[model samples]
Target: MRIGLYPGTFDPITHGHIDIIRRASVMVDRLVIGVAINRDKGPLFSLDERVAMLTDECRTLSEQTGVDIVVHPFENLLIDCAQDVGAKIIVRGLRAVADFEYEFQMVGMNRALNDQIETVFLMAEARHQAIASKLVKEIARLGGDVSKFVTPPVHAALRAKFS
Candidate 1:
């Protein structure tokens, strides 16, 4: 079975993330969306909240795409998470050239840690490419509309947080 792991903090998963998940899911038998804990980011939503939100968003798609989408929250090394889930591939979304450089570095490190695992890069759809979770949060924090960038649940969560 070809398993792909997509790991992110997902403080609040955006439409761009959904785009990548949808695209990536098709390429693997099972796509595990790892909601990782990023201590550096100190995400707006708690780990449980992020997992809940991601689970809600992926529920229907998991069935429709014929991909077993597992929302697993992890606080350890990414390769360890991949190993635990039996993921042979790691999927990443690239929004721009800058993202490429950063992901390239991480991919190199991941390769060093576990040579058996491979990384694949998916370009974010042009329309959704600019919609990043960090920017979406900032926009909502300042009372700007983020409805277009995120799903209904996430948009509602942002409103409740700022309002």
Candidate 2:
């Protein structure tokens, strides 16, 4: 089976993420949403919370696409995580040139570590290109509407977190 891994903190899975997940699912037999357990980022949501949010968001997408979507939390190198999930492709969502620059370096480093795994970049839809989890959280914290950037469940989770 062609398994692909998409790794991210996913503090609160945004619409941008869902867009990528939906698109990526069709390209692989199984799409593993690797939720990173990066403590350095001080994520707004806990690992379990992030995993739960991703799981909830992806259930429908999985059903529609007929591609198995699994949420796997990892605290190790992304390449290692991919290996753990038997992923030969690493899927990444690109929003802008800035994101490309960072991802380029990451791809290089990951290749150096494991040349077998390939990284594929998917450009975010224009509408979702500007939506980010960090910005979503900031807007929610400041009492702004984030309905356009995230799904209802995630928006409710953010509201509950900040409330």
Q: Tell me how far the alpha carbon of residue 121 in candidate 2 is from the true structure, in angstroms, after superposition.
A: 0.1
- lDDT for each residue of candidate 2 in 22-140, tens digit (9 for 90 to 100): 99998999999999999999999999999899999889999999999999999999999999999999999999999999999999999999999999999999999999899999999
Q: Write the per-residue lDDT of candidate 1 for residues 12-73, one digit (tens) a residue.
A: 99999999999999899999999998888889999999999999989978978978998998
lDDT of 2: 0.95
List clashing residue pairs in candidate 2.
none
Worst 10 residues of 1 by lDDT: 60-69
Q: What is the lDDT of every predicted structure here?
A: 0.93, 0.95
Q: Where is the poorest 10-residue window by lDDT in model 2?
A: 51-60
Best by TM-score: 2
- Give every collision pair in model 1: none
TM-score, model 1 to reference: 0.98
Off by over 4 Å in 1: none
